[model samples]
Target chain A: MGVNTSGAAAYWNLERYAERVAFVDEQGGICRYGQLQSQVDEFRDQLPQKRQLMVMVSRQTVPSLVAYLGLLQAGHPFLLLDEKTPAEQRADFIERFRPARLIDATGQTIESTLLDSGLDENPTALVEDLALLLPTSGSSGVAKWVMLSYDNLQSNAASICEYQAIVPEDRAITSLPMAYSYGLSVINTHLLAGASLALSSASMMERPFWEQLREQSVTHLAAVPFQYELMERLRFRQQDWPALRLLTQAGGRLSETLAKAYTRYACEQGKQFFLMYGQTEATARMAYLAAHREPEKVPAIGRAIPGGQILLADTEGELVTQAGQPGEIRYRGPNVMLGYARTAQDLVAPERPQELATGDLAVLDESGVYRVTGRLSRILKMQGRRIDLDDLQHTLAAEGWSLLVTGEDDRLLVCLTPGQNSEALLQSLAGHTGIHRAYCHVFERDAFPLTPNGKPDYAQLKRMQHESAA
Target chain B: MKAENQILNTLFTQSLGIPSDLVTEDLAYNSLPQWDSTAHLQLVMALENHFGITLETEDMLDMSSVAKARSILEKYGVEWV
Candidate 1:
């Protein structure tokens, strides 16, 4: 079955099911899809014509979801801004996007008067039109706005549902922020399947969160690698989640050891652990490793999901058909984003409009399973030797140390929590990589800097490295 | 010599990446610019390392400030001047 073809009509159809529990917020307030759709219609009736909408929402599930769908139905290309974003960053985003309308949940609303003036109430586009503009996480550098069409999102969600067997009866918990592609996809795919969603915005470390998961009988739990590591440290045994049928990890690579441990736990408890891989450019998930085959197949990101293809290409851009050879991972699918919006040019430039050359380097094993080696951007050239910081981190982790390695133009710094011998780790890294210990600086930090999404904040690490070097 | 004061001083300085001299007895944890949740975890880790003791889950949550950390450490036989 296809998603509703007409945007307004499809939203109205979803409104009929609003009482069935569409979303539960962090405060435990539940909002039905129908009620949310009504809110969207109301906002649409009040929105101005020929103007963009910028929404600033907390990681809260319900309001964010409502704002997202409402903007889409209104045919306005809305920007999703993280509520936790620093005030300076938020100001920069507003200046860059120059959105005429802003929907903020935290404080008094700005631009509400402009929207309430009723500039345009006519629906200009169908549900198949482009719905939202998202800023790429840009972990490597400056962020860019990505335009994702309705067809792009719908096709991706349908493909995800087909591959994961997501059905109407299945329930998923929103673990990540709605501003992120991964979290947003969870909401879309689950809603598309007409499934229930248990919205709990609290971090996994919060005590009440675990209780809510059990209380809600959440079957599917999706999280980033950091959260999984936290779970490992917390000793989140299989027995702790008797009602959880599936657990998914993505947003970054989960350490092989932790993946193995979680896999073992899942097997003993008769649960499935899915190791997924994807990017915001692809609208969330592109590949998933089935639960029963983890750790042993731990490093493998598995094959592509329905409607996606993973191909390996050499540095020369030649297709690397040989197995176990490293190459840049490329994806071709309907879900590939329309293109990035260039604020400077005031134009959307579609990169590889048909195929996305995901700058991630990976190897296709003999069994056709893909293992991401590292990002091309992550490669650091130090003393005439190219080094992947991720490789260095994995090597350190193998030696029983958790470290986050970040590189400046000329120097590389490794940060680790206290209790790990910094000198010993540096020596081990030098001994293993044949790089001299002088090239590495070790900092015994209390914890690695994390982004709002819980991933390591490499940019902040780089800044810290620069300051320390100075 | 309150153990809480000593523990608070060390934890506030180390976890928040501030100089020991900056962490006064009257300083509140949340009131500091750098003493966010991440710094709180660092302080906990540093205290755990310094005292050679693992804090209980409840204690970890309650030990939000330097003063509270000191009191929590006292329960583990860590005495301050």
Candidate 2:
């Protein structure tokens, strides 16, 4: 890998691997590495001469892929957002980040806008090394993004390739959104390893997705916890998909029952099931359970990757040395992000310290594997989307509602303060978050239970929820 | 409104949080912000519970639009009239 003068990594120079297959679209259309390089080169040539900040609504398509690679090759830092983001959130992003350009695509046609008031006229300064920006929270419409330098992407990709033993012959499918850090890492690692990818927006629930998976002979498949559950319900047969050599699960904790089932299935079928733990702040992955140890079936996140250290710290910020003691998972690695960009000005800010506080509580087992116990943050991951409860509360407050909100995965409990229109509140909450109304349980409470310190008693709320259900 | 149409309409509005007016035959999954992958499963479960039918995986995936959902329900012996 080579680093150019403008801080972009030259690893994308795919000329030598000319005849190699780089991409296979949903229709089984092939795009060789040579053609990919030419497309990227042509796309890059059309961009502005000077590097500019951009916002791209990334999709699972060959054109979107080319745009991303083209932007990176041109040394232009761009914020990658999911195409599913709401119109209001997109507007908020443009207003907050002040990106010079917006790149979006419909089907295979790339649409771009070079804002008349781009950075040139009202320039919000950006660090020279910032190569990418990814939202910490999924389509939650939060402005917070993890800032990554070219080094962060390169290092994480290398570590993933080393751990997974990725080879050029391996082929992966775009099962997850490319805007997601985990999905983006898959693309990065495969490209760096000279492997190939199949680009498709079709989800696993669809028959075409399975047909394509079998047709493409995809060797690698990565999914979140929700998708895994769906696979079980759909009675997905592992033996039928013989081409699947590597199966990775992340995004959130897979339920105990599903975890055991998948682990046993992998062991019996002689397939690899790598349970990985990661966050966007760390660029993508922090730890993974090894495939060789698949038979253990214990809920463990295994160990840190090469060149990374996963340490645990207690409430007082003291290191937890003894096994079985729970503490916050802290990681120190080159893959750690430069810092977060909350507003336009923060884009040019200096990098934070190298250490990353994962806000996840876990314990080290006797076997040296880390098993997550709980989350210290008020964040819920509903179908791979990270929703910060406190942030949602703030959004509600801004809309003139006072509500006590809490919930586990797939369920969000919102206690409406008395005298508020319950119907109006429910619709507002559902509409604002883009979460299904069915997932929310809107209850009315005259007074909420509070702790001695005056904080909302969430445990009491959970009890009330169960009681109401009964 | 017919009892079955009302039931279906209630399911769509309640599960998706969209108004009844938006629950047209052309209204499709993934076309609305509220009816994403997360909402899709919840809608599936709601329809099953309300209609007292178990949808096969293929039918669940193929039930993309409101019209398609109605046809799938019809296949499972639900009357549209």
Candidate 3:
């Protein structure tokens, strides 16, 4: 494979780098640069000629990757679907969007003939500008997609490459699902920098994951906090990696103890450990704490990524310059999504808002590093006063116990590790907030439930409460 | 219905949201998408409440399948008819 770097190339132009190695498979088979280009071209030929909305169940495979790239190059904006999406949900989205073509798991284009394509009626205007439609969160549906332009993807990838110093020599393994924004952004940034990727469908719990990662000589890796916990459970620290250069944590907040442990491990091993934070609205990366400042084990999410700006907005929507006063974390960046899609018609004419009001509450310390406090909506109203559920959970967390806080209007359910009594935790909550013990329900669980994305599925816990109540 | 099957049926349906028909001897954790870690927790909590037996951490983590859960319950002195 000949990787040509003769001129500046748009990261997505597969044809431009026809000679480089784009992906390495589990069997150690290499998919070269030109192969991806040819595959993209082949996929482009298979699509229906007319411009219509597309719904793709994005799987992590050579065919899926090439088809996605092909559709993007052909200027087809698509809604990426998780494979686990239920049949009824799929039918509902199909009915709502009336997508012209349905790209099945095998990369076959099936004529969705369910309804007349909705986007085709006013096709000329919106189809030209839209590039991608990602879910606002894990559970978002047809009515809610974060509309992204090619510009949004390109700018966010550029920002990531800048902060992380990604070069053409870098290669990252696919640790997250391709349907996820964070995982998709890894593909975007690496492609922008003309880097390579080693794709794997295996979970970290398997021995094959490490064997293949080593075989591919993967250089950089990123994961959610729960993955690190899994790695710890798997005794990953004892295993040595000679080629790995950068290790990053995102998707959710890692505990200070684990963050410090990984940071120390990275520092001692001469590798860079990055603590990052972002929301789906602002692409994948918004803020990153660099490795140079690794003396403290507890890392703060550093300043905004190069192309973005982070500010603290008070209750009145005013910027707070002074430190320690917490407010909603506000991010203004080019990568901020082009508004949201409620219907098929909403896809046209980029409606990107200037500022993204991140629902997370955070405060800038004296050193200008932002420490996320809690979420605005993760609050519980108890005794006629608003109580921060995260703050209450942190009380148990401070006691070095792993727990999950979830409940309804009047009570909060705290699920904790088995064999341990929640009496202390319950008393502490009552002592701090003046809420009665009756309002708190404590159950014993071995550990918190992890979602598909490797974050604690607090939403699932809430659903359990509702289901049990019903 | 057998004592074990009845207890397992209610646990699988009401607690884990598994279809009552799908709750069988062959049902395994992660064997189906619906029986993920979250469902596993719900099943564990429900089993504890119904059987009046608290599962330890090691036992909870090791409850991988319906057969496995039944075997573990037997070890806890849960008699099966």
Instruction: TM-score winner between 1 and 2, please give it.
Output: 2
lDDT of 1 by residue, B1-81 (tens): 235445667656656656698887556545654564445555666777777888776676566555666667889987777
Please, what is the TM-score per model? 0.75, 0.92, 0.73
**What does the lDDT read for residue A350 in candidate 1?**
44
Model 1 clash pairs? A7-A127, A18-A34, B1-B81, B3-B80, B4-B70
- All models, DockQ values? 0.18, 0.53, 0.08
Model 1 lDDT per residue over A89-161, tens place = 6666666655556777532236744333122332232123446767664222235767777667788888877
Candidate 2 per-residue C-alpha lDDT over A1-470 given as tens digits, one digit per residue, 9 for 90 to 100: 11233233344667767898998999999988899999888777667766677888878998789888888877778889888777788888787877777888642323245342245543335677788899877434765888988878888988999999999999999999999999999998888888899888888767678778889999998999888867876677533788888888889888777777877877777777888988888889999987446557356888998889999999999999999999999999988998988777787775676799888899998877898888888888876778888888888888899788898766789888789997888777766565666677988788898999999998799888889888
Query: Per lDDT, what order, best first?
Result: 2, 3, 1
Candidate that beats the other on TM-score, 2 or 3, i.e. the better one: 2
TM-score of chain B of each: 0.77, 0.91, 0.85
- In terms of docking quality, model 1 is incorrect
- Specify the poorest-scoring 10-residue window by lDDT in model 3 chain B: B33-42
Most accurate candidate by TM-score: 2
Relative to the true structure, how large is the alpha-carbon lDDT of every model?
Answer: 0.67, 0.81, 0.73
lDDT of 2 by residue, B15-55 (tens): 77777899998998778777766667768888888777788
Best by lDDT: 2
Consecutive 10-residue window with the lowest summed lDDT within model 1 chain A? A117-126
